[model samples]
Target: MIELLGKNLTELQAIIVEAGFPKFRAKQIMDYIYKRYIFDFQAMQQLPGNMRDWLTTHCAISIPEIVTEKTAPDGLTKKLLLKLSDGNQVETVLMKQHYGNSVCVSSQVGCAMGCVFCASTTGGLYRNLDTHEIVAQVLLFGSLLKERIHSIVVMGAGEPLQNYTNTINALRLLHEKEAFDIGYRRMTLSTCGVVENIYLLADEGIPITLALSLHAPNDAIRREIMPIGAHYNLENVLAAVKTYYEKTDRRVTFEYILIDGINSSIENAHELGTLVKDFPNCNVNLIPVNGNEHIQLFKPSRRQMEAFKNIVASYGVAVTVRKEMGDAIQAACGQLKVQHAQKQSE
Candidate 1:
C-alpha cells in the first residue's frame, strides 16, 4: 500500500486526481488526518463510501501502535514503545514542561553511532524510519493528548543526521500550514557529529536548533567514547558547527554527558571551554550519564556537575545542567525498549 501520511497537498492531490476524484479530496483527507487525528480512511465520514474504500485498499496510514506506555510519578513525562508496521519498534517521549509539551521523536529503529553509554545502540542499526514513521510519532502523541505538541526534539534513539533526508522531510511536513504548522525554530535536531550532514543541514534553510553530541572536549576522549570522533576529528566537527551557526544564525547546543570519572573532570571542562569560547551564540548542556541494565556507567556528584558547569561558564560560554526528568519511569532513550527486549528473551 502507498504510504499517505508524509505526502504534501500537491502529492496527495495528484493521487486522487489520477484516480478520477476531485482535487479537493486531498484537502478533505488532510483535514481529517491532521485536524481530526483520523488515520483510517473508512472513518472519514465526509469522503464518499467508494472513495474511502479505494483509499483503504490502495493507500495505507503507517501510524505506529503504542504497544506499551510508562508514565512518571510527576505525570509530566511519558515514554512509549511504539511498534511499527514491520514489527520493528522505536521509542518516543512526551515531556510536559511549564511552557508547553514537547515530543521527542526517533529517526531510526536502532542506532549505529555506537556511543558506548547508550542503550539505543545495543541492538545495532536496523533501518532508518521512513518520513511518515517519523511524522506519525508526533501525531500519535497529539492524538492521545487531545492537543498539539508545542515543540519537537529529534534527539531520541537514532542519529537524526545519519538519516538526513527523511529526518529533514519529516520536519518540513510537520511545519506545513495545514499540518502541525510548528515553526522550524521550535524544532531541534541532535546528531552524533555527522560533519558532512551538518554542512548539508546548514544549507537546507531550516532554522532548527542544531545540537551536537560532543561528549568530550578533545578527540582523544571523544574517540574513546564515541566512534564518530575517530571518523571525524573535533576540529572538523567544530568547523561544520561553525558553518551551521553562520548560515542559520541559530545558536548551537553542545551536549556533554557527565560520566563520573570520564569527561566531567576539571581538565576536560577547561578544554571544552577553550574550544567553543569564541563560537558565536552557543551553549553547553551537561547531562548526567544515565545508567541502564546493559552497562554500569556513572554520573558525577551534584557538586561536581556544578563545578564543571562553572568552569565552562567562566570561559564566557553559556552552560546549564539538564534537570532530571521521568525518573519514576525509564526516561533515557532506548532504555525501555532494551528492557522489553530482555524480557522477551527470557
Candidate 2:
C-alpha cells in the first residue's frame, strides 16, 4: 500500500491524478491528514464516498503504537517506546524546555554504529526505517504533547547519516508548510562523523545544525571507544565538518561525551580546543556519559566536567556542559527500547 503520510503535496498530486482523481483532491487529503489529524480515509466526510473507498483500498495512513511510556519525576521529560507496523520498536523522547517542546527521533530500528557507550547498539542494526516511519515518530510525539514540536533532533537509536535517504526525506517533509511547518533552523542532526554524508548534506542546502559526535580529542582515543573511528579518522572528520561550514554558513556543534578516565582529562580538553579552535564560530557541547549495564564507562564528576569546559574555553572557543534531562526515566536514546525488548524475551 502507498504511504500517504510521507508524501508532500506534489507527490500526492501525482498519486491522486494517476488514480483517476482530481488533482485538487490531494490538497484536501493533506488537510485531513495534517491539519485535522484524521488518519482514516473512511472518516474523511468531504471526499466522495467512492474516492474514499478507493483510497482505503490503495493507500495507508499508518502511525506507530505506543508500547510503553516513562515520564520523569519532574514531569518535564517523557520517553515513548513506539512499536512500528512490523513489530519493530524505536524510542522517541519529548523534552519540554523553557523555550519550547523538542522531540528526539530515531532513524532506524536498531543501531549499527557500535558506539561503546550507546545502548542502541545492544541488539545490532535491525533495519532502516522508511521515510514515513521516521516522520510518524515526530507526529505521534507531537500529538501526545498536544502542541507543535518546536524543534527536532535526529540523535536517537541509529546513525542517522547511515539511513541517509530516509532521514533526509523525513526532515524535508517535516519542514514543509503543508505538514508540520517547522523551520529548517529548528532541526539538529547528530552523526558519528560520517564524512561522505557530511559533504553530501552540506550541498543539499538545508541549514539545519550539524552536531558531530566527537567523543575523543584524537583518532587513537576515538578508536578505543567507537568502532566507527577506525574507518574515518578524526583528521578526515574534522575536515569534512570544516567544508560543511564553508558551504552552508551554519555553525557546526561538536558533541563531546565526557567519560571518566577516557576523554575527560584536562589535556584532552586542550587538544579538543586546539582541534576546533580554527573553525569559524563552532560550539562544543559536553555531555556527561550515562552509564548503563552494557557499558562500564562512568560520567566524570561535576568539578571535573566544569574544569574541562574552562580549559576548552581558553582557546577562544565557545564551550558549555549539556544540561541533564530525563535522567530518572532512562531517557538516553536506546535505553528504553533495550529494556522493553529484554522484558519481551523474558
For candidate 1, write residues 30-100 as lDDT tens digits: 88888889988989999999999999989988888898999998899999999998899999999999879
Q: Tell me, what's the RMSD of every candidate?
A: 1.1, 1.2
The whole-model lDDT of each prediction reads 0.91, 0.91
CA deviation > 4 Å runs, candidate 2 = none
**Per-prediction TM-score, please?**
0.98, 0.97
